[model samples]
Target: MAGEMAAGLAEEGGSKIKMIVSYVDNLPNGSEEGLFYALDLGGTNFRVLRVQLAGKEKRVVKRESREVSIPPHLMSSNSSELFGFIASALTKFVADEGHNALFNDRQRELGFTFSFPVRQTSITSGTLIKWTKAFSIDDAVGEDVVAELQTAMEKQGLDMRVSALINDTVGTLAAGSYYDEDVVVGVILGTGSNAAYLEKASAIPKLEGDIPKSGKMIFEKLISGMYLGEIVRRVLLKITLQSSIFGNIDKTKLRTHFILRTPDISAMHHDGTPDLRIVAEKLADNLKITDTSLETRKMVVEICDIVTRRSARLAAAGIVGILRKIGRGNPGDKHKSVVAIDGGLYEHYTEFRQCLESTLTELLGEEASKSVTVKLTNDGSGLGAALIAAAHSQY
Candidate 1:
């Protein structure tokens, strides 16, 4: 699957999938020093962060952050309602910072991490192509998200300017790049999967002249959290129907879409007891099936492993493809390479992380694999946004 996805990305307009070109020309060079704000609107939550940078020697000096949950209705409501709530929350956050000694009179600059499908027109503007992860705001589609956010900020009387509009994956890369120049790719494995990597401007035939500085390409969708559980559920559903393992059980939960979440599957996969007690308990609790035989228990465990392993292996393949695209596939290419990865699944799930690492070693072989590393970065949507804002700040 990773190989297939890579094949699509290698061509203009793509053969199998269309990869979006983010017109973000610049990446952080660890020299940007300022107080910047970051607004990250992800699938289920929005996070805000403020960072005070002390330039190359000191890096990030001080930081403060807050996370707020979006009410369910706002996800499907009007764009104004959604952005308004976000702006209101941001206003309070900014007000609290007013007392901080680190703050200055310079006009504030922000980096907005909008994790959705967007047709980017520039560093600070992009048209929403569509919503994903169950978001369905009708008016947001085709609208410039940066503009939407800026308008909301204005309504709240927030005197701040958006300096950069970034994808989460791109933010991850920026965050990683701020610390390490070798970091070449950024991937997100939670809720939804996607990747961003620096690509040569000449390689993207679909992108015309006036390309941005960082010449990068980001895959909007791939082996991510939102679809992994569904994939596992479909496989489990087929097996349950065919084998009748539960013997006329309710199976209603199994039938429901996304009833089996990625974290649930990851938890089951990590169970290591003799009889896999945790798996049995979770199956009973989540699926309402109990008193399973050893064979049934084993089957359940195997299913979890299978689903997780496939996702991890496929993720490894995607990483390999990116490395190869950039000529890092050679055994003697000694430049230490790093792929900065972020997301709850990649961070928390040990089995998944180990499997991904082992698969990369297998794919790249010993000599070549030594140079490539998958380094986990924290808070891509928050700290990363602040970093980009600092790098692109007008002040």
Candidate 2:
């Protein structure tokens, strides 16, 4: 995977991994002050947050946020409709905050955390490369996402400036760097997996124009929360057809794509009951499979374990690949490398998290592993965007 990242960075076409430039030349130094806003549009839901910073001493003074679910139809809708809905939600969120003396005096600055692949042209502007996850807006492709949001905000009569444009991984890295200087990489193992790591400007050959002082590269991976359950479902379907462990049950739900989710498998994998009640219940509830014997329940658990373990180990290898690319994976190198991780799979799924951490340590060996740490930054994507906005505020 690391080799693929290098190829993607060097090659313009036909590369699996896209080491796209983020144009985020600098990370937060913890000196950012004043009120800032963050708009996070990742998947099915988008979030709006307002955070007040008091520099290095006070950190985040006050923060409030709201999550709004996007209508299913809007995922594939035109850019105007989708962004307009987002703008309206953002307007309402700002209105709900009421009149704030701190915000009323100045033009509000916002960081847009767009968790899609984008070709960033500047710190505050980027063109959408392609939409991932559930989003497939045709017109939005190659469009300046920041500009779209800016126009939408204007149409809604909201006075806000988009100070920064970033993806979730970059936001995580920024948020992590604000607290820990050792954090060099940010990995998101959520609904979709991706990573961002700082790199020397000269290291990226495919990068065009005048390179900044530094650059961050984005790496998208296939192993993530969004596909884990689907993988398990396919395996179960295969076994059910061949072995019929599920008995003579309707396999309609099992055949349905994404009918079984990561949370369901996580619950089944963590079943500790002597009879594996949770596994049976999940199979019954999600797939309508019931009256499973102890052996069958154990098989289901094993399948979940297999899928989760594979996903975790693969993610670990990817992280190590990043470390190697940056020369931090050398045996004698004692430099501490902290990877700040966000996303539901890394946060909520205990088995996946443990497997990922342990696999990382295993791949790095005992000596090099001692200098590595994986820290979870909860809601770091949104908060980190706000921090970046503060760092680049117009005021």
> TM-score of the candidate numbered 1?
0.89
RMSD of 1: 3.9
**Among all candidates shown, the one with the greatest TM-score:** 1
lDDT for each residue of candidate 1 in 292-395, tens digit (9 for 90 to 100)? 88788888778878877777888898888878878885699879999999988898888889999999999999999999989999778888888888877776
Give all candidates' CA lDDT scores. 0.81, 0.85
In candidate 2, residue 234 scores what lDDT? 92
For model 1, what is the alpha-carbon lDDT of residue 380?
82
lDDT per residue, candidate 2, 1-395, as tens digits?
66777777775652556577887887888888777899998889999999988888988888999999999999998999999999999898888665552645788889999877677778988888778789989999989999999999999999989999988888998999889989999988998788899999887887784322212222222378977888899999999999867789998998999999989889999898999999988888889988999999898899999989998998999999999988886678878888999999999999999999999989999888888889998776799899888877777
Number of the top lDDT candidate: 2
| Per-residue lDDT of 383 in model 1 | 85
